[model samples]
Target: MNDLGKLEDLPADYRAELTSHNLVPLWPSLRGVLPPGKPRPNTRATFWAYNTIKPLLLKAGELTPIEKAERRVLVLANPGHGLEKMQASAAMYLGMQLLLPGEWAPSHRHTPNAVRMIVEGEGAYTTVDGEKCPMSRGDLILTPTGLWHEHGHDGDQPVVWLDVLDLPLVYYMEASYHINGERQTVQPGRGDRQYARGGMLPTPVFERSAKTYPMLRYPWAEARAALLTMGEDMPQQEAVQLTYVNPETGEDAENILGFYALMLRPGQSLRLPARSPACVFHVIEGGADITVEDQAFSLTEADTCCAPGYTAVTLKNRHADKPTFVFMADESPLHRKLGVYENRG
Candidate 1:
């Protein structure tokens, strides 16, 4: 009687399923037989870097000898985000570029649109497809897909600027490619060359392509300086930093890969809405303690920090002598598409 063996070899799940469905049809409760969390949903994060990215810019003399001697095209890539899931169409990145007292970022071009915000140091110019424009701190420049460009600074001090490109966009599109120009890197010509060098009434000679980009440079420094001069007695905005717009379309260019500069007087603090795009901050002069998404960071001249999106932000000037000046970036172009807001004048 004890010679009979038990069904130890059979898995419990299979046995239960067989027992339940032996003589049955597809019943509604059959699905309940499985475990509660089997084949779970993907609740993990798709991106790696914090929505906020931090960058530290260098002037010519500040870097090591080796760093200064090389091709000075500095780049900040995704901070290693979207590691697995890979959100390509959307781009989130930041970087700071420094063209020493006499350095140049050679001629090159690729896909995935780009934008730059000049921070400090000037007498630098960027030549896109041979169209040149001297860059000044607080100006905005756009380099759309497939445009050839290069950078050089013949100024006294090193020219440093913020660089924002949607590398993720190129990676996502699976069309990523790059190339280096001649030995000198730049187009071997001087200020006499490029677009800005042409007469005052500047316009693209040949359509560089469709409505790729209208204006090469948006002089943010001059514009912001004017705004301050015009609104000397205006009440300060509580938490909102002013946005820069396209003069023609009134579209908020600041939201796209662009930069905005502001000066905060001593003891003055600005509170900003939480929904704005993540911003990277570089101190131009003086010092400040920034509250990003309520997270705090102490910064001074040459110091760098970042603020994430979907969280409120505030900037407080903590220094007495020099006024604190800050430069920031965001997805301002997309902001225009959504019609959530705009930048005028």
Candidate 2:
């Protein structure tokens, strides 16, 4: 018998008629379709240890060259969700891509907006539309939709970065498009960081899939300094956060994905109540205890955690020596755009 305990007892002819009309019994689905209380999500909070996956990433790079593999990535799959698909949650997709020295991931552009957060090592750069944005550890880079981009490493050591994209939204709309570039460009132009220049600028026309940031690369040193200044006025117990914004509008609320930086000093714990929209957080430095949806998880430098939508999260910096920094990539922009984003806190 079916879970409802009655659907299977229906007459075969009746079932056939229901199928012919493209209709099915709702009794078996009512529990999910119509719940008793507030809405709950299927996605779960999960964590990935950097130490456990680092060796595997290096091994993959050793076995398969970047040219042959295209993109060598280890996706942080949510245990609550099926592993067959590369996704962090139902709304977001996050992966750790490694680029070995002297290797390159051929240029390609797709519809899903992407944010690259550098985790370990450097001397690697992502070239977007003939402009090369050099990447350093803790740097955040934006690869807007439909922009040709490629990652290459010329440094002595391998480089790894978190690739967060809005895959669920793109797939749902059935608007995915990808095209490979002829070859990696040897020369790349520099982008202007207009916001840093402190000049008034006129509002520019907005396009659906266009460049949002005047500068694609957000360096770590500058971000750190800003966080430090923000901490001066912020309460000691609270976490200091800053969003990577589009200089033209001074907003991080892009069309699909959102990016931000968070810092928590030792003994600081910030609790985020249950909210709708999945978020991928990468540990930039230090260690902490993170509670996601009432489950406890330990995260150290280079580790990653996914707080799925409708899940409560709390971050505690118990380490005695240093501060904990995390880079967050989320689908809040898309949710906000649809006017469905919500939070209980």
Candidate 3:
């Protein structure tokens, strides 16, 4: 019997699935979410690593009653006390957010660079700053470091999306900052040109007036279409060689300790052989399994998981229905200083 509620009750075989995937936490695994010796069993690991060694389940059975009832965004930060110590570094924090159908997460924004990957949704749209990003499944909509953003159901049924933020990275560093958006809700396309990452004429870099990241959004659909039209395919043992560029300087997203996206397709998996930098992964669409140093776990839309630091991971999708994709992120502190990062998986 599989019981997601009790982490320890998980079937030994299923839980054993993670055996080979080495998950090395960036910080020594914390004793508990609250202060140590709080009698909470100290299972949680620095807001990022799963409390127990088992992979986290996102289904109704897995969530606490409050999380299921309130439709909140569950976060598992990277295993760091955290940095984003300043608003500038906030853009690098990543969070995994899930909203059941008809769930409306009241509007809010902070000084962190943010993005949403449509994991499971027939129809949804995120109005960022003021521009609306049509939420097709697997689409990536960026909410620049700061700017008001909210989710609404203007289409049919429920939707699931992954939210990534570098908050812990900032919080641990004592650089956390928050600011309420000026407007209650802003339209995206109907003449709201200033707030969008795409479909806008404003500069992408952070401005003196804004509290967070410089750019406002990066639409995944547009990026996906471009990749598909490129007439390219993944190389053996490798998905594809693609990197998010800093539009202003032709640099990679890591240059600024920034966040970015990576795509995967059916029967595609890159063998991540070793841990270099820590990253959080959000499944935008389809299905795939991750292998971290001998441990492996499969995931689908609305499902989020983290890859611990110093351990490499391989992402593979065996789905036959449509192309499976992922929106992945990392903290910029160490990567930016190194100027480069790579994965053999």
lDDT of 2 by residue, 159-255 (tens): 9988888886688789977888866565443543434443455345675325455567788888887787778776653769988877666767357
User: Candidate 3 has what TM-score?
Assistant: 0.59
Worst ten in a row by lDDT for model 2 = 189-198
lDDT of 1 by residue, 143-236 (tens): 6667777787788876766666666545767987877664233334332222332124234487443433545676655555644553465656
Model 1 residue 297 CA deviation (Å) reads 0.9
Model 2: lDDT equals 0.80
Better of 1 and 2 by lDDT: 2
Stretches > 4 Å off in candidate 3: 1-71, 77-107, 181-215, 230-237, 252-266, 273-275, 319-323, 332-334, 338-345
Computed on alpha carbons, the lDDT of every model, listed in order, comes to 0.56, 0.80, 0.52
lDDT of 3 by residue, 207-231 (tens): 5333233333455665666555432
Flag the better candidate by lDDT, 1 or 3: 1
Candidate 2 lDDT score at position 2: 35
Residue 290's lDDT in candidate 3: 76
Candidate 3, residue 323: the lDDT equals: 68
Q: How far does residue 201 in candidate 2 sit from its true spot (Å)?
A: 5.3
Better of 2 and 3 by TM-score: 2
Candidate 2, superposed: residue stretches over 4 Å from native: 1-6, 184-189, 197-212
Clashes of each: 14, 0, 48
